[model samples]
Target: MLAEVQADELVSVDDLIPDQAAEFVSQLSTVEPLPPDDDEMIEDETSENLVEDDSDRSRPVRENGSIYFGECRLLNWTTTAKGGMKADLAILDCPADAVHPFKGLLCGKQNGQRLRVWFGELADTDVPMQVNYQGEALLLRWSDDSVNGMNTQVMLDDGPDGVKGTHPFTGLPIGRVEGHRMKMAVWAINDDESVIDPRKVKRKVPFYQKPETTQAHLLSRRPRFISYVKRHERRLTRGQEIRADITIAPDEYIAEALYAILGITSRSELGDENAVGREARRRWSSLVGEYFDDFYGRR
Candidate 1:
């Protein structure tokens, strides 16, 4: 095609452009138009999906509101886990509300009902968000007298397990959960002020014991008390034993202390065929038991 402006001045080419001419432009290089940004993609396009599938890494988790079913000790944090303060309300009949929240992570059922979770500073490793409760479930409501200094109901995974807790009375290092036994938990208080079942109640946590002014349960078992006294004496002879705050030491009038604490005026009194000897034996045994409790704190 010829330029219209240049054709008008051309005398020789005027007849060649007799009819018409179409204008055309020549390319400087072979550059294509850039594709739309929406259509553009990286050389190595992504193949993985944004959402992930459940893998072995994923674990069962629990939370504050999680419910459970099992037989675990009801600890009272209201007074702190200083000693094993068991729950006076023994929930022997807990709910059989065993649930399998996750694979192989079932909370076993107990007697009466499933326990509602109330976590207080307990953590789970497998699932960070989900909660794995401190311990077991199931609750039976056996109401007793109202506890002293009773606090809120909840769960506590951290405790006197291993060498984690300190001794309440002696202020020494506690080696283990020495006096732990499973008991009932207080669930929810009935609005009507009526006694409710533990599983129905809705709380978690402990109880206490007395020995000084009150008689210890241990005294009821004469054989066990005698055995305990003997064992305690042996531990005293053992230089590096866990005898907490006992005054008498190894090879230091241990026998005398025993006799004095028991009030055994003579060894023959132990073999007393006479009623007088029997009375002395009884006196000494009782004294020795009291002494043991004095040093070892009531469980």
Candidate 2:
């Protein structure tokens, strides 16, 4: 179940995002994150921290009169990923009214360095461009380089699971998309079979409810949180560990920070379904209990 948030507690829907993000996202209608500053750049492992002030990364960006659901903490931004793989954590917040946009950030380890990305700039991975709207049965395409791309072309109506509506490749509805906010489960695909396989390590992502909130509120909000678990594993070993991260929309710093803690801790405690599930539930319960009195005492 989800906790109830008072409207008073939320920034007026209009002010959900700050001015900078608003202006930046607006330009996505025709622009894209200038390619990687340098091809030799590498991802930073320590750049994972949330924006403490309502500065650049924390402010929300507006689009189509709705809050843009893209923002995150910079996790890594290296001149070169080198032989090892780089992981990132980001939180997306596509409101019911806003176009569900996909974006991410790469960070530099010093804790302050980072790079931002709009879904349009992520074409490298072939992130699904067009998804059949579940309710409308319309295929939306990424037309230009802007946030929603450019033009939204409805290719086809809703159909089978893989073809349209909601499916894996089309990460739309892939995360928790409900009410005023949504959350995403992020992963970094690596070359190592052991790392990518669910049997070795699996993780879920978490998100904040409103545009602006404290770390306590960020930690307390559970509905938008992603829960991860290892589906297959035995005799967990430290060397086989994997890196998993988290992200929050409207800010890159926070996502990186959440990723480091959750990733390192969760990876160290890898376990089978029963054990992992139990731990996840416990962590969730404890978190929810601390903030929501209504959720704490109940099953």
Candidate 3:
């Protein structure tokens, strides 16, 4: 019976001899038991430790060095050393919660030459106007949504009625505004020529009606305006370039989000497969990563 059991035979206990059954039971008791697995327990403890460490430490936070300005108004236009007109702008609004290392006005100039002749008229009118300059047609519109009453926006290859037009400069297909759209407001000049008191004129009013003199001051909070101008002036005197560190990576979701944010439907419309497209994609990725990190990093 023991030999048959060792050969894998299905033998009943009743068929086994008493001494054989006793020997089988004794052998079973002598066999060693398998060790318990500790891998699962170790893994659980490691995960718990990781969660505790994460809870104890805060994620590193850094600022996107780019300077952003909202409710911007053109405070003044002055002649630069190269005879080009330099526009001083007041940043009336910004991300209030953000840490702005560069808090001030932004000066803009083009090609060491005076701005296109129509800019003066546009500034003076402060109303929606279409003007043809440098073989390109541009539509300018004013709004008062930013502050009490101050804002200006420009659209290219489109009229005041929001109708698309053929590109005046390219003669290629035109779809929407190209390059950076300027959102700006012109400074309001006082109408009364005899009254020189700057205190009497409010800075929040739009410049629709022509004033007696061309001289004008920025229409924003006095303190903020002064501080902005001073900061820019100091930077200019010191000859320092404010460096903005931007980082970007190639990501499909980031690209889609950027397209929506930029109000564009097709990536091809943005000159895909070209240098312009590559740069746009890079910038969009950087912008998304900087402003909307949660969305950018979402799985």
Against the true structure, whose TM-score is highest? Answer: 1
Between candidates 1 and 3, the one scoring higher on TM-score is 1
Residue lDDT tens for model 1, 107-158: 1222233332221211232323222122322233333223422112222223
Cα TM-score per model: 0.18, 0.17, 0.16
Report the lDDT tens digits of candidate 3 across residue range 1-97: 1121243333332232233222322322211222342221111121011110111111111111011212344443333344322233333454434
Q: What's the CA RMSD for each of the models? A: 34.5, 23.2, 37.3
* Candidate 3 regions with alpha-carbon error over 4 angstroms: 1-70, 80-83, 99-182, 185-299
lDDT of 2 at 212: 19
- Residue 59, model 1: lDDT of 20
What's the residue-level lDDT of 180 in candidate 3? 21
Let me know the TM-score candidate 3 reaches against the reference structure: 0.16
Using lDDT as the measure, the top candidate is 1
Candidate 1 residues lying further than 4 Å off, grouped into runs, are 1-114, 117-149, 156-224, 228-289, 293-299
- In candidate 1 the C-alpha lDDT for residue 191 amounts to 28
Worst 10 residues of 2 by lDDT: 193-202
